[model samples]
Target: MNSLSRQLKQQFSILGAFVVSFWTIEILDIAIFSSYLDRFGIIPHNLIGLRGILFAPFLHGGIGHLIANTIPFLVLGWFVMLQETSDFFLVTLITMIVGGLGVWVFGAPGSVHIGASILIFGYLGFLLFRGFFQKNLPSIMLSVIVFFLYGGLIWGILPGLGPFISWQGHLFGFIGGILAARWLSSK
Candidate 1:
């Protein structure tokens, strides 16, 4: 196969693996652990809670939470890696750190933040801003498409949108995604 085809294959495979891992972990958490794993999620401002930064995205409160996150995680993540598959991992890293930290610092004192919404918002921010940073037609077109498709999700960042929703995660995730896009485009 040609190099581009190989890259596409690799990209899809990576995306599939990530999505699968999310499902697999959720299944195990629900079926085996009875959601005990969710305790590992981000607990704002607690010293031990810092560890959630590495585990929260992978752990969901329930099947509903995991299902809710699955589609966007797959689609947006696929699009983010369209040009450079490596960006998926980098964006994930930055989103988790920034979003997790933001939630930990700003989220309700006793609340534990979980779910992949942070990465979803991060992908939204990345796609929206990548075009501006890259300054190219294809990127611009991609940005427009992403905006039209997922713009409604922007409301997720607003405070008091939902008692269960982590607006802090969404807000910080967007910031992290912008940071990733800026950092990547600059380099």
Candidate 2:
């Protein structure tokens, strides 16, 4: 294979790794929790525990919940890596860590949020804000397309979605992504 093809394959390999890792973790979390559902799920009233922050992101309520999160994660993650692999990983790691922590610190106790929606919003925010700084036509156009495509994300920020959904995590994750992008661009 040519050098360009090899590079593309390498990039895709990295993306695949990330998607598989997340899916694996999610599935394993479900399997583990299936046997001890009560012990694993975030118990909002007990917010002071470490589990409130770390375990919450891993546990999904059901298979449908897992599927709902996994698809967008793979698709949006592909796009983020395509734009810049390093940036994608950095932003994702920061967002997940910070967003998760944010939820622990401020979210209602026992609230568990599992999914990539928060990360998606973070990517969107980074892409849009970065476009403004770089003033790149391509980035700007892409940002516009992303904004329109996920325009309804604004509503996701609202608190009324459901008692089970951790909108707080989603909100903080998005914010973390935006902050990461700005910091990355500045450097």
Candidate 3:
């Protein structure tokens, strides 16, 4: 294979490994929660409790929900991680913590929404901004394409989309990602 193809393959392999690991953990969390559904609740009445952080990303309402989130998680994750593995992890970790905190802080009592979109949006925002600043043609093109494709995501971040989905969490995660990316780039 040519050099470019070889590099692409290697990068994809790395992304695949990351996705597999994330998927495995998610599945395990689902299995554990399914077996103990009575014990876990989506709402966070307590302040900054353990469940506030751990449970949101792990728990899904159903199989459809899980499937809906998986592709975006993998694709956006690959994009974000491809630039720099360390940045990928940092963005994801901060997104999750900040997103969850946003929900806990602003969400209605008994409100809960769980998915990877927030982190995905954050990563996308970071990539787009980075690409713009760096003046990298390919990255800039990719960001434009993604923005056009998933532009509707902005609406999902707003409240009143659904009773169950925590748009607040999504909004916070996205904002956190944008802020983080900007901060990272400035340094």
lDDT of 2: 0.65
**Count of clashes, each model:** 0, 3, 0
Weakest lDDT window of 10 consecutive positions for candidate 3: 35-44
Could you tell me every candidate's TM-score relative to the true structure?
0.96, 0.80, 0.77
lDDT of candidate model 3 versus the reference: 0.66
Any residue pairs clashing in model 2, and if so which? Answer: 43-110, 44-109, 44-110
TM-score of candidate 3 against the unseen true structure: 0.77
Candidate with best TM-score: 1
Model 1, runs deviating above 4 Å: none
Tens digits of lDDT, candidate 2, 136-168: 787678667767776577577668888877777
C-alpha lDDT (0 to 100) for residue 122 of candidate 2: 67
Worst ten in a row by lDDT for model 1: 12-21
Model 1, 93-116: lDDT tens digits are 998999999999999998999998
